[model samples]
Target: MFQPWLATLLIWIPTLVTAGDPAETPWISLKPENHNGKHIVFVTGDEEYRSEEGMPQLAKILSKHHGFHCTVLFSIDAENGCIDPGVLDNIPGLKALDDADLLVLFTRFRNLPDEQMKHIADFVESGKPVIGLRTSTHAFDIPNDRKYHRWSFRNDQWKDGFGRQIMGETWIAHHGGHGWQSTSGIIPADMKQHPIVRGINDGEIWDPSDVYTVRLPLPDGCIPVVMGRVLSGMNPEDGPCEPEERDGKTFDKNNPIMPLAWVRELKGSSGKTQRVFSTTMGASQAFTREGSRRLLVQACYWCLGMEEKIDGKGNVSIVGKFKPTSFGFNSHTKNVRPKDLLD
Candidate 1:
């Protein structure tokens, strides 16, 4: 009864399941040498700003240099099982959040299915620390009929949804000139001592990404740590944006800079307070600068309540080869799977 064709069919079954199924897409894992005992799960899916590239490198830095176990999940192209930010609905491996100490979210306008989305919802309810990067403010674009519709960025029923309720703000506007104007991080005089900015100095952190507008005086209990000075050009040394006249009023873009990074203590459904850190700066190109990388690493420490370990001059070096693609729509590297990033 051992037919030759049956053996061939059995051999192909495993390959078919592995290659055709997006839900079985592999996630990148980085084990810590020093072992800090904390696990950080980075969920990256954005059509622009290359969150897929940036988050993996951040995970490496945290894992190799800082002693934390890191897992990076990507949106998978269901057709070929490759990483595709445009594939907004299928970000597998979110169940890793169940045991994660911190969740680094950098998605934009995703509408994941209920089962996958439930993991994120449950994580939030557990009152765990969350680090939200650029575009994360408008992370979900779920339909009203869905169970997780309240997580949508513009859900009126939930009053601006996840971004507003958890991170303290939703997408407002591009405060700075997109692409043309860049951002220079400025630690406020009073906030210089904050643990999140302990290793970063005023004007040291510069990101090619422009500043995003936030409704200010930010929501209650939220503290702005770093202010963003809109620059005239996309260089770190560029001068501040010039004043413009609008409706008989002169508007100075940097006279009152926007908050580049902020922190909040949010009460979760579990009635436990969770640390939330939100930053409008995390473009792939931004991590090329040491100051920008340091800011994020420091923020991770602060989020974990390990502020005592943050050194102003600590290591936040790039773990491996990283030449990030510039930010643009449909700009992600095609056909690349998560396993391809390990090299």
Candidate 2:
């Protein structure tokens, strides 16, 4: 039997209940707004693992503030502290690859059923834009399956999993002390003029709580967007203990301490091209302020080819904490500031 939420979502179909709007109850908001022709979908629900945060709020922000037509899909079952709210089973009015402009995914150590996975595969095959956060790369789990292996960076089913191959890294432990650190001396000079990076500068940083360092190479055509110097004395989530002697050391001895955030154009086997923007870090509360927020908003606009529209509006700025609350969401106030890419 289908769960009540799943059934309700399905019944509502193309008509979705706006999270906070009573008037738009049980109906998807399809009204023509600034994002009239744009469609963005957010897949969230990994709460059972580390923390259930970010994804849902990201969708809401894009929808309400940026005027993006957004849909958020949660997992059906909550397993191992990971929530798999079973959204795929409902289907609602959702169809595969129906003019979707972007697919934003954030899942943990959970595998989607074959049918659900197929829907995602079909969507990606459509050659649209994709943005993944944190555990999204290795979000699934299915050993002894070639299809699942391809999504992982490391062969060990217990280790690298799917995230490494797609987003370029699995979740390694944080090197910097808990909380956030301001990034310095890492912004790409060449990309300084790029609108997506406009207003971002040295010493400006987003507080994504903890950032992951990629241990593998990204797909071809990937461009580095930001790089950071990793502080030393960090341990993998389930790896060996932190070195007692390395407590104050600010650099990793086993690996290069430089971490990167990037964008890429991927060409799949089907000859379709997809645009992707990945960052090792961008979920911290600090990111919702100053240059970091501006960079993210610009990146979204650029990905949607709406940079021109945003540019005509002058500078763009957003303020708030990007961190998710107990309800797994956050909010931001947008303010257009001047574009100063070189800054």
lDDT tens readout by residue for model 1, 109-179: 99999999999999988898999998999999999999999999998889898899888899999999999
Best by TM-score: 1
Give the poorly placed runs of model 2, Cα more than 4 Å off.
Answer: 1-32, 48-53, 77-98, 145-149, 156-164, 171-173, 177-185, 216-219, 229-257, 282-287, 309-323, 326-343
Each candidate: what lDDT? 0.87, 0.50
Alpha-carbon runs more than 4 Å astray in model 1: 1-25
Best of the candidates, lDDT: 1
How many clashes in each structure?
0, 30
Error of 2 at 106 (Å): 1.6
For candidate 2, what is the lDDT? 0.50
Worst 10 residues of 1 by lDDT: 12-21
TM-score of 2: 0.65
